[model samples]
Every structure is written in C-alpha cells, then in structure tokens.
Target: MDPFADTLQRLREAFDSGCTRPAEFRAAQLKGLSRFLQENKQLLQEALAQDLHKATQLDSAFIRKEPFGLVLVIAPWNYPLNLSLEPLVGALAAGNCVVLKPSEVSKSTEKVLAKVLPRYLDQSCFAVVLGGPQETGQLLEHKFDYIFFTGSPRVGKIVMAAAAKHLTPVTLELGGKNPCYVDDNCDPQTVANRVAFFRYFNSGQTCVAPDYILCSPEMQARLLPALQSAITRFYGEDPQSSPDLGRIISEKNFQRLRGLLSCGHVAIGGQTDESDRYIAPTVLVGVQETEPVMQEEIFGPILPIMNVRSLDEAIEFIRRREKPLALYAFSNSSQVVKRVLAQTSSGGFCGNDGFMHMTVASLPFGGVGASGMGSYHGKFSFDTFSHHRACLLRRPGLEKVYALRYPPHTPRNLRVLLAAMETRSCSCALL
Candidate 1:
C-alpha cells in the first residue's frame, strides 16, 4: 500500500495553503505540543518503558529560524519519543510542516505517537506516519524539503542516497562505535562508575554511549575490579532484578548481544535471560580489534576493553576508524585530557566523563566522517530546519552613484572607482 501518498499530498496542500506561515500559528503548535507532553506524561513514559524497557525524561531557542517547508523525521527505537519529537519540535517552531515516522521496532510507543499525539496539534501542520523498512522505502520516494534521520550508519547511507534523488537536504544523526579511553593516571573507581552508568543506562542502547574502552594492559587489570565493584554497588550482585536496570529491546538484539559475549574473555557479568530479554552489565577483557564486538556498534549493555600500551597508540587507534558520534577520555591530568581532545575528531567530545557533553544545550551534537553529518539541539536544531535566506535591500536612487563602473571603458573612471574603494577600506581599517 502507498500509505504515505495521501497523507503527504494533504500536508503539501496545507503548506501551499499558507496556513503554517504565521508566527502565531507556529507558537500555537509549540504550545499544543507542550500541553500534550504535560497531559500525556504518564502514558508516554509507560510507552517508552514498554518499548525500550526504560524511561527517561527529556530536558530547546530561537533565531530568524524560518522553516524548511515539509520535514520528515525518521526516529530510532532506542529513544523513540526523544528522537522523533526533538526534530518535530524544531520543525514546528521554525514554522514548517512536519511528518514524523516513529520506528516500528518500538511498536508500543509508535502507536502512542501516531494516534494520541495528533489530537493536541493542528492536523494540517503535523502528522505521524507508522512503518518499518519497506514502508519507509516507499515513504522516501516522495520529496520533502528536509529529512532528519537517526539510526545506524548503514541505514543512514540509504536515507542520504534516497534524499539525493530529489536533491532534498538532510541531517543524519547516525550511530558509531563510540570510544572511551581511560588514562593510567586516573582514579579507577571514578572511571568505572562513570563508564558503567552510561554503558548500562537503558541497557546501553544510546547512540552516543561509550561502546568500548582502550587502556594499558595494567590499567585494564586495575579497571576490572573497580568496574566489578561499581556494577555490584549500582545494580547489586543480581543486576537482572534491579528496578533501575533495563532489558534488551528485542529478542533479536538479545541474541546478537549474546553472540558478542563469546568474542572476549568475560571479565564481569555475562548472564542473559531469554524470557525477559535481559543481559547483565558486562565488561569484556582481552578483546581483539578484529572481533565481532569490536567490528560493530554494541548498542547493548556490553563493554569491551581493548589493551593499548600508551596514550599515543590509543589516539592513533581511534583516528584509524570512522569518527564516532561521541568520544570520551578519563584522566585527572589536564594535559593528558587536553592532548586527546586536541588530537581527535568526533561529532562530540567529553573529558573525564561519558557523553555528558550532549546534556549541555550550548554545545552542538553531531558526528563527523562516517559517524554522520550535521548537528542539532538548542539553536542548532532551529537552524537545521531553517534556510538562511540572504536578504539585501538597497536604495533604488543610487543609479547615478553606481554608474561610474557600469559601461565606459575609461582609465579615469577606473582609477576613481579604485581610489574610492581603497579609501573606504582604509577608513574601515582605522575604525
């Protein structure tokens, strides 16, 4: 079925009708969205918990921020509402019509977003569509002014290629195997705690979450016990039963994570429960660079540790791969942290922390190279959905003044014009 055709046509008609052109209308839509969140807080949370096995609160600014006509947002399942609504909010606030395609992998939350969300907003300005891969392929066949996609790099390529056909501008917020380097000079417990909290949060499904660690073999040995202590303290001996802990989002993901457990020596928690889709807060040591775990982005609660002799090697290793969405380094030494910061390239970087850079609204969030391109959050989001149109209004009465260089090939006129330009330049330089 061409499920998107009718809805897209309707939205195009609405945009052409100029109903979404007013600042007042845009504000009303944003206000309606705020009301929707306030009223359906519990429902949204429940849906998130049901779909991703966890719930987290999301915690936006203005520019000339003109909208890009109709925008398509393709969100991932891990943070369904967050990924979907973050872009949607920007598109609407910038005065653009939006079509949200919530991930069908998180069917529960997708239903909530598709069904209940529209009630609070003007239907003509916004719509939510539901689909998996095939339907998404069909949806991409139509043209949109802007497309914001968040998913794996493999699929990000597909989205970019599809958008290329229509020459549609796009923002790809794709995932990569984010790297976290632990310096030998740091506190093991602190590093372990920070790494564990982020790696295991929402079962480690975050796109920006640290995927693996690189440290000296001695540091790796030191980190193991500290990480064990941290995990035990955070989730207890039985992490599976902890209320704060989360389960894998699907059986397929659980199986894939289970397969990765075999790649390295399991230094901490390797238990899995098929019934609940639970994988313990795990840390693997003696992991090779070529292993399956190292080859892909582990979007689960599994952290693999690869040994490196020194910081130089670590930076070189990181630089060799596709630049990740997020990068982290833990060091009490300011010089050491600064060295890594200056030497590496990533969408975002954090020192002595794990992906906390993303929490700050002032810094833009995105990736470089294969990780992805473009950024959003705060002013970046508003700008992402807007086209920076150049506007210059000159006085029409300057025809005589502008005619000096217009036609006559005279040396006198050329010299005079050059002198005038040089005089203006010198005057500005003095100021």
Candidate 2:
C-alpha cells in the first residue's frame, strides 16, 4: 500500500536485470541527459525563471568504478536544477538506477523536473519523486544502495539516521558557517569586490559562500567603505530593484534572514520586504561571536564583519568552531596565506578569493567533521557513485605458479613464494 513501493520495486528490477550495467548503457543515459538539457533549454530557463534560481581508469591491478544500485539523490531547493541534475548525472554515469527527489519548496522547477525529466531517460532506471517532508519520510523508509543529499546540517542528520537503518552509504553535502579572513596587508577594494560577489550570489543561499569576515579593526574600517562601493557597483543603490540580485527562497527564509539583520550594526544594507521575499544585499559591522549571525550558517544576502586583533587571533577563532564547508583567506603575503592554510581545517580552502576552489572540476568537494562527508566532482563524481571492487584475473594455466601460495607449506616453499612475490629485492648489509 506504500505509494513509492511500485516505483522502487520497478527500478530495483531494472537494476537487477543488468540493464544498467553496461558502459554503453551508462554512456547512452548520459547522452540522453545531455539531450534533455539541449532540447529543452527554453523550458528549463522558463522553469528557472519562475523559480528565480538555478573519468578515468587503470589496468588489471586497479580499482573498477562500478555503480551502487538504486541510489537516492535528495537535492535541496537552492540552485535546484544544477544540484539536482549534477548528482543525477554522476549516479547515472556510474550505471546506477536512480530515484531523484527534488525539493518540493522549489515548486516551479520541481514541477518541470517531475513532469518532463523522465521522458529523457529510461523509465525503468529512473524516477522523479515529488513531495514535502511527510512523503519524503515515507520514501526513506525503504532501502537504497546509496544516498546523496545536499541541504542544511539539521536535516542532514535526519537523512544520515535514515540511511543508517538500511546500512546505506551516503554523501552528505551539508552546509556550515564558512569564515573569510582579510589580512591588513590586502587591498581592501579587491578583497571587498570578491567577497561581496560570492556572499550575495544566489541571494547568498550558497553552502560554500563566505559566511562572515574576520579582520583587524583597522582592516575592517577600510573594508567597510570598499564593501559598500562593491555592493553599490554590483547591485546599484536601489538593490531591491536590481535584476541581478535574487530574493530569499521563501517567507520562512526571508523572516529568518530579517531576524539576523538585528544581530549586528547595519553598516551597508539591511532592507527587507516580505511581499517579494526580498532581503537586500546587506553587510553588518560590530558583530560578536555570540550573535546568531555568527553562530549559524547565514544562507542569505548578509555579511557580518567581526574584528580580530591579529592573524593568530583569527586562526584561533576559526579553530574553536566546527570545521566549515569552505574557508577563505585574503592576504598580499604568500606566507600569511600559507600560515592560515596550514593552521586551519575545512572542507575546502581558497587563497585570496571566495569559493573559487570549488569551481574547478579537478578538485574534490566535500566536508569534514561536522560540515559533512564524502566528495564528488568530475572523475570524483564517477568514483563517489561507484564501489571499487578489487578484482584480479588470472589464467587457469597459472595454477602451477599459484601452487606456491597453497597449503602444506614449508620454509623452502615460503622462501620461494616470498622471493617470487617481491617486486624489488631487499638489501641487507649483514647478508
């Protein structure tokens, strides 16, 4: 009587029948996905407009990237299309049957994905589930081979707990309070421009966005004006009307962000309108470490600057908190940047800029400690979705050669076997 039972059973059967196991099959699925994007470009654009957002291998002694069957991809509402499809591509390319659960909060994009996406893929190997928490809870009750989730840490725990009952492997792409340190040696304008762009990108819903600033009070003084200039240049004086700036995703989110506006002195912009879910590209000064803005992941268009007397103080501040998803340090001195890098830990790090490290496909992206776990991107994506089953292929005629490893062993046999197995000879002066 479970609503998802039939679809789950069908995908399981499709995976078990070995229909998704071939490289040809996986390649075709990827091609189909590409086609879906290309053919329906306008449709996707319109859907996003409504929502207001959006390989390698080795020889016989190597790891095989084989799929984990029946993967569940739980994507968040922010940047819905990209987050949803990126994981989908990885799972499909790895030859797994996937069940994608797009966030219901992004109703417009979710509708398009649910109604249109299935037409592009093999129906037997893929499905799109639509619902809020209640239905998602029901769906997670059933088992899956792997789970990939992107969202807040609060809900990440729920996902992890559910995954545990089924003994499922997971990639929890959770968010944290990322920190950006600005050394006194840096150009205030250059640092300000980079930080503003990333902090307010996607209305600041980004998980890897620089959450707050740590700088000397002297640097904070100079940077405040520069940050204001950057905000003005980017979003204009009337930021609420700027087409480039995005609104908070929901009333709840807007209210949450509006509440944070009170945590620190409003230095640049602290405007809000519930009618449009608009929260202006804001900057806060005089923020304390104990404020809600400093304590939580500020997933909105607000930046708080906290004063640190020295580089050591800033590093100490960062170390005390839970490891962040991403960390940024801006300094004219390479040694200063290196010092920060060596002294701290984060899921990812970028020197002199925002979350640019994540833009490259070559780097693996995931969190450590409380931030999250597991990494995925480019070839890492293919690998993350795969189970590396160690395999060795030998000819039956080699049984005589392998007999040295068999039972009824002796010291002579052991010596011969050891000598034959060694890739290099051991040198002993005593010998």
Candidate 3:
C-alpha cells in the first residue's frame, strides 16, 4: 500500500466519524499508546541503538491525559522513541487520529513502531508511514489540518512553506546554535557542573543543549578545570569506554565535529577513537567568533568555549543570530536573569539550569523565528491537534426588551433599551 495515502485516508475517515468528539475515546487511546510503549520497551531500545547508538534510558513517555483531533507527526532520529511516542500520547488523550512518519534513517525503529502502534491503538485509526524525502514530499502534497514536525530548520522551512498552500498550521521543532552564558557572579564549580551535563548529554544531540559556553577570560580559567572534572566524574576517566555516554548519531555528524575541532583550540578532553565511532567529551576554548563551529549548531559531544568581555557582549553575540529553541543562563543574581529573559526571545529559557524545561508540561515548548514555530506538550499538545468549534447559543422569548432597539427610536424606547441592557440593577432608580 502507498503508506502516505492509506494512512491519510484512514485518519480522515476516523476524524469525520465523530468518534474524536468523545472525551472517553480520547482517554482510551492515550492509555493504549502508553501501554504499547511499556510492553515493547526492549524493542524500542534495540531499534534506537541500531539507528543512533543512543541509550534506552534516554527514551521515556510524556503526558497522556489530554486529547487532540487528527494529526500528522514527523519525528527525527536524535531521540527517536520519545520524540515519536511522547507527542502521540498527548494527541490521543486530546482525541486525535494520527498518521506518523518515523525517520527512515532508523529503519529498525520504524519497524518497531509499526509493530506496536496498531496493537494498542484502533488499527483503523492510527497508521505508520515509512519512507524518505520523496515519500514525505508526496505526503505533504495532500492537505492536513495540522502538522507536528521535528527536524532541522532547513527542512522545517520547506514543511512550513508547503503547509502554507493549504493554510495548514504547523509546529516546527527545529535547532540552532544555542549559547550558554556564564556571568561574573556565577560560582565556577556550579557553572562547570551544569554546563558539562548540558553540553555532553545524549552525546550533545539535544536541540536545547548548550551548544557552547560564553565566559570571561578570568572565568574560563576557573571554569575549564571544573568542567573537565565534571565530565570525568560522569563518564569515568575514559569517556570513550563509559556506558553512560553514547556515540555521535552518524558519520556525517562525526565529520562535522571533526571539522569544527580542527578549527579551534582544545582546552580539555580532545580525544577521539573513530574506529568505534567514539568522540570524547571534549571542550574547546578560545574559539573565534567567525569560526564555523560558532556559526553552526554543534550537535555532538564537542563543546566549544568562547571568551566574552561581559554579559553585554554575550547578549549581543546571541542577539545577532536567529532566536534559539532555548537560551540557558546561569546566574544567581536576579538582575542578570531578568535582563536576559526580558530582552531576548527563545522557544524557552532556563535560569541556573539546562534542558530541564522540556520535561515540564506546564510550559508550552516550541521555537521562534529561524529556530522554528509553535509549541505542544500535555494539555497544550491536545489543544494543538484539535480545533475548537466555538458555540454561542441564545435563549428564546426575550422579544419585548429587544423590541426597544427597533427604528423610530424615541426617549421611551431608549429608556427601555438602556433598562434592558442591565440584567441586574436597582430597578426603580431612573435606570
């Protein structure tokens, strides 16, 4: 079967059926998605490793109590399972039917998704479509009410441009060169501890992870040692052999990092064993502002630390670029935190923390400008998928009061109309 056509057809049928209107049906689908994930835990882990060398612990379920309407999900390979299943859980709870396009780079993961979703979901309602750019292009030719796309900004642009033909609203989860600032007031030890985790986790594949650290020359001198120590503590003396850390996603990603490191100075952990596709949790210091590593989104285990004169310099540096999916600031001072939050716009921000904002469903997650657009999580996700059909029902038999509004209006009629406008008031008082 043509996966895109068949899948879209089924979702259209389910949406038109009116089953999606019932809150009960939505809740049931949410349960099914979560149960399917739990039952097939091992399968998800295996497929992820084959696709990206990511650990199973990095994958987990998100909110499930809300429901949406009919949605098409385009997931990426970075965090394959969570990116695919988390939003699906929210969609079902919001009463949505779905057509999902799992990333073709991870062939095994796609098969696992196909195996599990049909088992737990209403088979006639939810469908998995598998293919690459051509299949995606074919699918986009059709009209969908909403699209939830997770990928790079370059492709996100094409998705959004195509969506415009149908006026289809979209949520684009895209990436950017995120900047992490270290203020003069920041504790060196605390800054090092937080930045190390944010820059290296998932082998630095996260969109919101700190792409590079902006610190003063004096601060970097103190911070460099602590960051190196933190990385060693988390991944052991040899990060290459540690099970806690994962490898870069693919060779293309590896070469990208290799080029960046070639252009910068290494302050700490500049080690790599390409034979096993392993790159150390290395930190690069003294990187030039014009360098390619600073110019692009560094999605790898490599961390490039650049020196800045002041917080103003850091803010100015970040301002010149596209709005990032996230802006991470580490400062105990209220003034610095307020200045960054108020002045800059990002999909989200974290104070004295990194990448933890995504876990909370209360805050709607998304990007702005070049970073991409729209947000969804938990109830927000449900709302994102379902369109609200507003109704303003009126009661009958209030003719006398409204009759005063008729033409040939006079003092008496005006008085009556004014009186009628007040549903509750002092009746006898000239009103």
Candidate 4:
C-alpha cells in the first residue's frame, strides 16, 4: 500500500466535506496556529538554534478568499521555522486543508514540526509529512489543489512539472544571485555598514540577501576598508568566535562555499572550518562576470565585488542576467537611485539600503523569471492560496429584465444590451 494514499485521501475527504469552508472555522484554525507559535516559542527557537546554528529573527477583495482545497507546502532548510510556518499560516487562514513537508535536511526542526505542530490544529484538516526527496516526489505523484514551494530553482522546476501533471496551481519562492549597486555619490561607510550587516546576516543564507556588489573601481577601493570596519564592529576580528556568526547548514554546502572562495582575490576574510562548518565574513575583489561566484546564487557569507565603470554599465550588467529576486542601489543622488529603479526589472528593489524593504508586511515577497513565480506575504499570502471564484446571483422573477441577454436579436435590443453590458468608457480599464 502507498504510504501517502491514506493521508491524502483523508485530507481530500475533509476538504470535500465542506468543514473547512466557514469563516469562523478558518479564523479559529489561524488562532490555533498563533497559539502554537506563542506557546512553543522556546521550543521552536531551540529547534532553529540546533538546525541553523544561529539566531532567528494577503488579501483580496470581495471576491471571497476561499481555500484551494488541500494545499501542499514544501519549505526549505535555510529558514526552517519561518519558511515552514509562514506558508502554513497563509494556507490555514485561507481555509485550505494542508499537508506540510518540512525540509529533511534540518532534522532537528523537522522533528519538532512533525511531532509538535499537528497537535494544535484539526487532525483531519492538516498533516506533517516526514522524509527527504524520495518521499516528497512520491507525495507529488498525488494531486493537490495548490502547492507552495520555497527552495532552489532546480527543485522549483521539478515541483512545477509535477503540478503540471495535475494542472495544479503553484507558488514558487526560489532564490537567485541578488545584486547590490553602490553608486559613486554614496557615503562609503554607511553603505558598507548596511551591506555588510545584511550580506552576512545568518551567514548570508537569506534568499533576498545581496549576493554581490557592482560599483566603480573607485567606490570598491573606498568600500573595502569601510566594510572591514563594519565587519570588525559586528563580528570582531575573529568571526569564527563570534556568537552572531552562523555556520553552513551542512557539510556539502560548507564544501561548496569553500570552493567559491577560490573564485577571486579574497580582500578580507577567507577562513573556513570543516568541523564547525564555518565560513568567515569574507569579501572577494576583482571578480569576473563569468566566474562561478558570479554565475550562481552565492548563498553564503561570501560577497564578491564586480567593477562597473558607470551607472549605465551597472544597469546593463544587471539587465544582462536573469531577473534576480531582489536588487539594491545606494547613492546620495535620488536621481541615480531612481534611474536604477526605472531601468531594471526584478522581483523587488531597495534603494540606498539592503533588504529592509522585505521587513514591511505591506509588500509582497517572492521572485520573478528564474528566481521563481507567484508571491505571498501579508494579505498577498491569503490571495495566493485562494481561488478567486467569480459568482453572481439574480432574482428568479427577473426573466423579462434578463431577456435582453437571450436570443431574438433585434437592433434596438442589441444596442441597449451592449450599452448596459459596457460599464466603463474605456475598455482597457478592466485590465
């Protein structure tokens, strides 16, 4: 017998039963999820500490935010707790029956989620599956109403393929090589502080973290010392000993990041520890666009500097690559910042700073093009997990008024009907 057969059937039955359709029930489940988080704050934090080795940190309209039936949420290991709970919150609040598949790589947190999280919600409406890629692939063989995945582009493609088999809709939140542009008009020290803080946060494991720096050679020279100063102030001389610094999540990733250190001249820190899985807050200078460090999403504590002679050159360089998940520009001149914003395309953009734009709940978070598709955050999440079903109702006695829409084609009746159907002066306004 298939292991997932029973659970999938059960959740499908629960969704079909209409038990999860009520607004009050959905609100109650959301509250239960909140209570679970509030009550297990310490446990979840401990799980994050054990798994990640570091500290932690919508909407729609009158269209009716109805659930997409049974939802499948596949979360990544980097932000095990957040990536897991965030999509779960959205699915529940949207009134979907959910099956959460936590990353097997983050075993500690996975164990906690599987063992502890389900107790807080209706068992028939929710479940936590355990396993690695094999189990996930097997689970995907079955159909789901909606799927939300947070991971690499490669896996996102696989999830999309699987969803296509069932014509199921999906929301993929994938990572990319996010670029940060530092203009000649900026304060070197302030830019350095913000860039260094965000780039090295969680050992640079964040999906939206600035992956590399693009600037004039002169700005690079000035930023090197200022960035060194910020690093020392944040993590001290030996980042290895700093409690604030995080370790690579796995041995495989540690080896991969170690290999990236060889791509360019290590201007600052290049130290690594296999036993601790530590990669120091490092900076690379004189990196080329073709090198491995520049080609891929450097999801680690390694920041490479690439030279762009002017603002036009910088924009051209960014446009040449696939659209990134996030982009950043820093300059005293608002015109320079605005120019970058106007010229480029990305999932999100920040000016004169790092990823603070994501901290605001008003904004939707996800990627575009190669980064991935679909968005969710705040009300956006609710909308993403819901199906906007178009509905209309009319009085049974309105046959005479509705007759204009029926057959019998007369010129005057047609003109009147067309006029009534046309709600706006401009047809494009509906777009």
Candidate 5:
C-alpha cells in the first residue's frame, strides 16, 4: 500500500482498536521517545551537520525533548532533527499517536530516523513515514486529526487548503521576513550584538531569524560597528575556523546566496569559496527594497541593514509587506513598544529580544497570514492531533421542563417559558 493509505488505515484502525486512549499507553510511548533522543543524540546531531552546513546541538537538544513527552512534530528541511523530534516528545507525553514526516531533500537524516524510532518505541502505535513527494501527497490526502507544518508560506497555504477540505485542524509554523527594529533609545551595543548572533545563526537559514533591520539614520551608523564587534567576539577574525560558525548546507544554497550578492554592493565579508561552501558572514548597507536580496528571503550569512527615517516609517514598511511570521522590536521606550505591539500583526513578537521567545515552550509558536497558519509547541501539539469531543447526556429529570417550549402557541405558556428560561444557566447546558 502507498504511505497515505497505510498511515490512514493504521491510525483509523488503531483508534477503533481502543489502542490510543489509555493514559498508560501514552505515558509509555512518551517515555520511550525521551529515552530514544537521549541515547541517539550524537548520531542525529552528526547527520544534521552533514546535511546542513552546521549542526548546532543546543537547539537540537532543545527541540528533541518536545516530542518525547507530548507533541507530534512534522519538521522541515532547514533544521530537520530539532524541528521534527522536539514537538514529538511533547505529543508522546500527552499520549497521542505520533506520525512524523521529514523532508525529502535530506535523505540521510530521514534514513536515520526511519531506523531509530521504531527500535525504541512500539512500532504499532508510534510510527514514522519516510518517502518523497508521492508519499507526503498521499499522507495529506487523509485527514490527520491535527497537523503541524513548518516551511514557506506558499506551501503553508496548500497545507491549510487541503486541511480545510477535511475540516481538519492544522498548525503551520511558517516563515516570512522577520523584522528587527532598533530604536534610538536602545543601547546600540546590546541591540546589535543580539541581532548579529541570531541573523547569522545557521547562516540565517531559520524561520525566526531576523530578515532585516530597521533603525534611525543616527543609530544605523552606530549599529553596524557594534554588530561587527559582536560578530568578531562570537566567531573571531578567522570565522571559518571558529567553532561557533559553520558552512552553507549545499552547493545549491551556496549559489542561491551567491546570486543575491551579485545584485548589490558588498558592504562586508562578500567573499565566498564555492568549493568550500563557505560564505563569509557578510553585511550590506544602503540596499533598496527593489534590490534582488531585498526582494527575496536572504536566508544566508548575508545580513542586509536598511535605514528608516523614523519609527513610523519602519511600521509602515512592515505594514506594506506581507504579515510576517515573527516580528521583533529592540527598544527601551515603553511607548514605542506599546505602539508597535498594538499597530502590528505578526505571528509572534519578541519585545526587547529576538528569537528567545520560541524557547519558552509554554507559549504557542506559529505564524499568521503569509507567514503560516496554526500553531504547535508543548500542549498545542497534543491538542492539534486530537479532536475535542464535547459530551452532554440528557438527564430524565429535565424532560418535562424543556417540553413546554417545543410546540405550544398559547400566551400563558409563552409567559411561563420566558420566566423559566430567564435564568442564565438554563440554556441546554443543563443537559
């Protein structure tokens, strides 16, 4: 059978077989996932390194634990293991069936997961499907009780559209140009340091990574130097050798980033060695919105900084663009903070911080509009997969009380009915 038919049959059969509802069963599956991650940490970490230029273990370990307890994570290619397994841990804990779908582009990591999870958990209850477009296409054809997708917004739309056909609830953790605002009141050094770290992580191939920076002309002048110093402190002068920095994922990604650099003048670190797949951490200034890099997601080590006349200009710039998946403001002024928060619509906003908000685990991390739809993290993932079946059993004692309003047309009965139903709690809630 095809993956879709198999998965649907299995999930449906499992439900009908009374296999998924027991707390003990769910607890056991969750525990197995946690132990699986702890035991196989190094193997998975190494595979990500081989696939994507860098395999940052800290983020990997953080996301892995999510699925072990109570989440069903469907992670994407950019940060495969961290995104995929983290939410799975959360689902396992919540006692839900976990059916994961890893990206097809990264075949190596997919192979590793297909072998590992089944060895640790009961294959019947917790299973993962490894296939390409054909299988994934089929998997979606059947309605998942809940779905979590992290990718580009274009694909997010397709996922949501398909989900709507089944009336299946979904959470799409998608990407858009996440904005970073640098207000004049903020400490230039602190703000730039934070921005540079996140902007360059994974060579900027991240959903929450700040896509561009907005600032006043005066602060813009000061911010770049501070950002340079922070980059040096973190990665050192010889960034290629620095353990903190890593390479681009593949030749295609290297070319894609290299192509964007061609459209504008290189402000800093424009050098790249194609054979090495090393694009030096670069920064660009004086870039226009029409520039090739500005027109697309600069998901590379290249950081593009733009100057805005005032805070209002920055907000307007954002408003004109698609609603971003994540929005960030770095300001000490409470007024600016309130204004931006109230004026803007983003999937999530980090006040005086960058991507640290996603680490909270307690908060639902997902996007809105062009960024994506739905949300998953912690309890959000568990709820995403299971249907909330509300129950109301009618009691024998309430039958006569409700019957008078069914068919009577008398004025006396109408008056009596209005009096009886005047109580707030009397509406169908009593059943």
Candidate 6:
C-alpha cells in the first residue's frame, strides 16, 4: 500500500479547496502551532534528550511571503525538533500544507512529532510521515511543491535527485568538516574555552560544530594544555559522569567516533563506554590530511588539530576542501580575524567564537558547494518556501497611447517610443 498517498491527497485537496489561502486561516494555524509548543514544552525537551541529546524565540517580520503549496520537511536527528519546526513554522505561516518527516534514528522525538504535532494543526493541511530510508524513498515518489531537507550530504544528494524528478525547489542543510583556526596572537585560554564549549555542545553532534583546528605548531603547543584545562573545567575530570556531557546517539555513531580516536595522538579525553554510548570529549594532535577523521564530518565529541605554519596556509587548506557549513577563526588582532574572513569561503563565518552566527534570526543558515545549498532561518525560511510571483498591472483605457507601436509605425513614432522607454528606464534608475 502507498502509505503517503492518503495524507498527500488530503493535503492536496485542502490546498485545492483554498482552505489555506485565507490570512485568517494561516494565523489560526500559527496560533495552534504556538499552543503546541507551549503545551508540549517539557515533552519536547525530554524527546530531545532521548534523541541525540540536545531555543530561540524569534520575532516575526513583515514580508510579502506566499506559500508554495505543499512542502516536505525532512529533519535530521541532531536538533530534530528545532530543524523540523523551523522550516515547518515558515511553511505554515506562509500558508502552505506540510508533511513533516522527522528522522527515524531519533525514535522518541519522532514519535512525539508524528503523533502529538498533527493534533495541533488542521488535519487536512498538516501531516507527519514516519519512515526510514525505504519508506522515505517511497514517500518521495509523490510530488511536492517544495522540499526542505536537513541531514548528511549522501542523503541530501538523494533528496535533491528526487526533487529533480518533479522540478521541485529544495533547501539542503547538509554537513561538512568545519575548520577552526587559532592564531598565535590570541589568548590560548580564552580561545580554548569558546572552542571547547561549542565543540562539545550536544556532544558535538551539531552540523555547524568545529570539526578540526588549524594553527601553528607553537600555537598548538599552547592550545593543547589550555584546551585540556577548558575540557576539565567544563566537563570536570571525568566527562563520562558529567551531567552536561551527552552520549553518542547510537552504536553506529559510537563505533564511528571510536574509530576516529585512533587517527592521531590523543591530546586529552579519549575515554569511551559502549554500555552507555559515551565517548569523552576528545582532542587529537599530529593528524594527517589523509586520516579518517580528517576525511569526513566528525559529528561527535572528537576534535582534531592539524598544524599549519601560517594564516595563508590555513586559509589555503580550507579552500582546497569542500566549503564548510560553518568556519571559525580566533585571534586578538582584528586584522588577523578579518584576513581569515576575507580569504576563506564558508556558509557562515565566526571570528573569536564558534557557531554562534546561527543564534541570530537575521542571519541565514545553510551550506555551500559540497556542504549543501540554499539557506533558511527567520525571513530566509519564509522566502525559501515561497515563490515570488512577478506581477504587472496596466490600465485598459490607454488604447490610443498603446496603438502607436501596433501596426503602421512611422520612423518618427518609432523614435518617440524608443525615447519614452529610455526615459522610463532612466527614471527607474533614479528611483
């Protein structure tokens, strides 16, 4: 049986009926969503803890946003509810029906989103489709007007390909091995604290988390102990027992992270407990470019340090790889920070910090090249799910004025029309 057929058809019918077209209806749906968030706040947080162990309330802005019919939101396990709801909010507010597909990996969060979320919105205009890979493939067989996917690059490619079949637009929020450069001029302790906090936040499962560090050998020497200090201060002597520390989401991810620890010399925190799916917040030095940890996005509590002699080399090294989702550079000198920012390309850049660039609603969040494509956040999310229609209106009473270019055009008339068009162009330019 086609699992998605009934719900898709219902949403399609609802859209066709123009039920979601009215401004009041959209406002009501938004209100319902607000209530859902308010009523189920603790449940959502518990689900997040159960999922991979993870808010900003943003203000609404006025924009000429229009919905793109039915939208499919495929959210990742990491930050599952946030990613799912971020796009869903935009779609709903812009007046479109949505089919939210939360990650199957996070079963607890998936259950809450699939079961509890739908009740808050109109059944005809909203639905939650639960599935793994095979089921997702089946769901993609049907057409959607717009698709917003947040996950790995491999699955992002698959989503893009499926969207291609229907010529549907997509926003892919994918992952990459984001790099952080620490300059010799900066205070090692300050840089260490900032990097350590973000690197180990949510056990470093975040897509925009710093995956590796690029710095001079001297800087590396200073940073190693400072980072150790930061790790200890944040998670205490044993990260395994730290309440702030999180466990790996699954055995597959745990094994992958465990394999990464052997890539280079462990600088600090290399402990792992398979029974609890815990891998300590680890740092490695002397890592080679070809190593396994360097090759892929390290979506765990593992940090690798690769030595670069100068800022130029560090920028060049980042340029050679796929553009990352987020990039970081730490330096007391503003010129040094600006130089790195000007030299490298990333979806987002942060100086003297981590992925805090995503905290503000004004900034758009996304990836570039192999990292991913398109972006979403506050207004960007609304714009991503909307189709800007070009419209023009003209008065019908200007028959004689329009007839000059119709059939019998004299040379004088041609010159007059050309001059009028040029004048209009110049006027628009001035405006």
Question: Model 6, stretches more than 4 Å misplaced?
Answer: 1-64, 423-431
Candidate 6 C-alpha RMSD relative to the actual structure? 18.8
Local accuracy of candidate 4 as per-residue lDDT tens digits, 1-431? 69999999999678645578778999999999989977996798689879985330011123555788999999999999999999899899999999999999999999999999989989999999999999999999999999999999999999999999999999999999998999988899999999999999999999999999999999999999999999999998888999999899999999999999999789999998899999999999978888999988989999999999999889889887989999999999999988888777799999988888888889999899999899988988888998998543334564566676565657676566656655444221111
Q: Check candidate 2 and list the clashing pairs.
A: none
Residues 1-431, candidate 6: write the lDDT tens digits. 99999999999677645578678999999999989977997898689769855400011223355789999999999888898899999898889999999999999999999889888899999999998999999999999999999999999999999999999998999999999999999999999999999999999999999999999999999998999999999989888889999888899999999999999889888989999999999999989999999999999999999999899899889888988999999998999998888767789999999999999899998899888899888998888888887433444465666665554657676556655555332131100
Cα deviation at 320, candidate 1, in Å, is 0.7
TM-score of 3: 0.78
Residues 1-431 of candidate 2 have per-residue lDDT tens digits of: 79999999999678645588678999999999989977996798679858964300111344577899999999999989999998888999999999999999999999999999999999999999999999989989999999999998988999999999989999999999999999999999999999999999999999999999999989998998999999999989999999999988898888888999999789988878889999888899988889999889999999999999999899989988999999999999999999888878899999998988988999999999889999998888999999998764444464565676666666676567656644443321110
Question: What lDDT, from 0 to 1, does candidate 1 have?
Answer: 0.87
Q: Write the per-residue lDDT of candidate 5 for residues 1-431, one digit (tens) a residue.
A: 47699889888677645566678999999999989977996797688769974431011111122222222346688788888886676566556677888887667787888888679997767878877668777777876666677777777777777778877666778788888888999999999788888888887888888998888879878887888788788888878888777778778889999988875566667888998888888888888888888777777888788889999899889887888888989889988987788777899898887898888878988888888776777777665554455444444455566565665336676566655544453243211
Error of 6 at 270 (Å): 0.7
Candidates 3 and 5: which is better by lDDT? Answer: 3
The candidate, 3 or 6, that scores higher on lDDT is 6
Q: Please give the lDDT score at residue 190 for candidate 4.
A: 99
- TM-score per prediction, in order, is 0.83, 0.83, 0.78, 0.84, 0.77, 0.83
Candidate 2 overall Cα lDDT vs. reference? Answer: 0.89
Q: On a 0 to 1 TM-score scale, where does candidate 1 land against the true structure?
A: 0.83
Instruction: Please list the residue runs of candidate 2 whose C-alpha ends up more than 4 Å from where it truly belongs after superposition.
Output: 1-60, 423-431
Q: Give the C-alpha miss distance for residue 12 in model 3, angstroms.
A: 43
Tens digit of lDDT per residue, candidate 1, span 190-258?
999999999999999999999999999999888999999999999998998899998898989999999
Q: How does each model score on lDDT? A: 0.87, 0.89, 0.81, 0.89, 0.76, 0.88
Clashing pairs in 6: none
Local error of candidate 5 at 85, Å?
A: 1.9
- Whole-structure CA lDDT of model 6: 0.88
